[model samples]
Target: MAKMTLESLRKLRVEQKEAIERRDTGDKSIHIIVGMGTCGIAAGAKEALNVFLGEAYTRKMTNVVVKQTGCMGLCHAEPTVEVKMDGMPDTLYGKVDADVAKKIVEQHLLGGKLVNEHVFDYPARDIHKE
Candidate 1:
């Protein structure tokens, strides 16, 4: 593998820092990430992502941002979704389709209510815990 130069490393660090800062800040906007690996795509992840982005844009939700990522280690439950708001816990919704994505926008984003049945809330383990 090619070694990263000092400048390249610094740039990468800066980008990482920016992303973390954005996630940590008190922004009301929700971040939605659609897993887009082969399994996810085969399950219609792309359609879900498009629905999310389109709705966000149509509603003029400047704060809401949509992105795509690879497999989230849940191949059986492809087309997974990850939603993060400032105060609420990060929600992972699996088996998402366009309809599910629309409901996410309507119920979660607009209503500020979590769709409990669809959410998979894995507890975050603390590394410092004894």
Candidate 2:
């Protein structure tokens, strides 16, 4: 990658600031990925994804990006959600419902806190590797 010029750096700073504003003064926005494998779909991951999207749009959260992917390899923990923040390590939450999604947005995105009980800190496979 090339080093950013002063002007480019300023542009990046402005973009970051706008993202923070979209997050409502929260330091980092969230990237939410809902697992859509067979198990996950069976467990209602589709509904969870819809809930996140609805919340993002209704709240006008331009910073929060939501997406869908295949299996996370934790069939037991179906309906998984991968949450990524700017500075914090990624976290995966399982068995998510609309209510849980709302709480995640409130407690995690807004308050910058992790919901410990719902976090899946360990996975059998290394999905992060490329």
Candidate 3:
């Protein structure tokens, strides 16, 4: 490896910031949250996240936000994804593979149709509240 230059480090930082800006500075009307908790990752959530990112970038989409978050409390449905659209209710899809992730982008995000069957009906309130 070559010696690290301060100037090069600064330039890398700038590029990193710009990438974050690109993902954040948008309409934010569509958010794809991929759960990356331990179980989720072990169940292939990482691949699902990559697929979503690829789809978003391939389509030159700016308004869509693809992010990762902790467990959504559905351990049985480890590789779960949540999509929050502009006008539709937040929908969580369970057991999502790369194929399902692609469908989410093409159908839900682009075509405005929820992917059926995989949709999960998670409970809203905590157990104490119930």
Provide the overall lDDT of each model, using Cα atoms, as 2-decimal numbers: 0.81, 0.82, 0.84
| Predicted candidate 3 versus true structure: per-residue lDDT over 64-114, tens digit per residue | 778898888887887999999887778989999999899888888888888
Give the 10-residue window scoring lowest on summed lDDT in candidate 2: 121-130
Sort every candidate by TM-score, greatest first. Answer: 3, 2, 1
Q: Superposing all C-alpha atoms, what RMSD in Å does each candidate have to the true structure? A: 9.2, 9.0, 4.5
Which pairs of residues clash in candidate 1, taking residues 3 or more apart in a chain or in different chains? none
What ranking of all candidate models by lDDT puts the best one first? 3, 2, 1
Tens digits of per-residue lDDT for model 1, 1-130:
6998999999977986686576674457689988898989999899999999899877757578898988777777778999998767788898788888899999988888987778864323441121
Give model 3's clash tally: 0
For model 1, what is the alpha-carbon lDDT of residue 2? 92
Give the count of colliding residue pairs in each prediction.
0, 0, 0
Q: How accurate is candidate 2 locally (lDDT)?
A: 0.82
Best by TM-score: 3
Q: What's the alpha carbon RMSD for model 3?
A: 4.5
Off by over 4 Å in 3: 1-28, 127-130
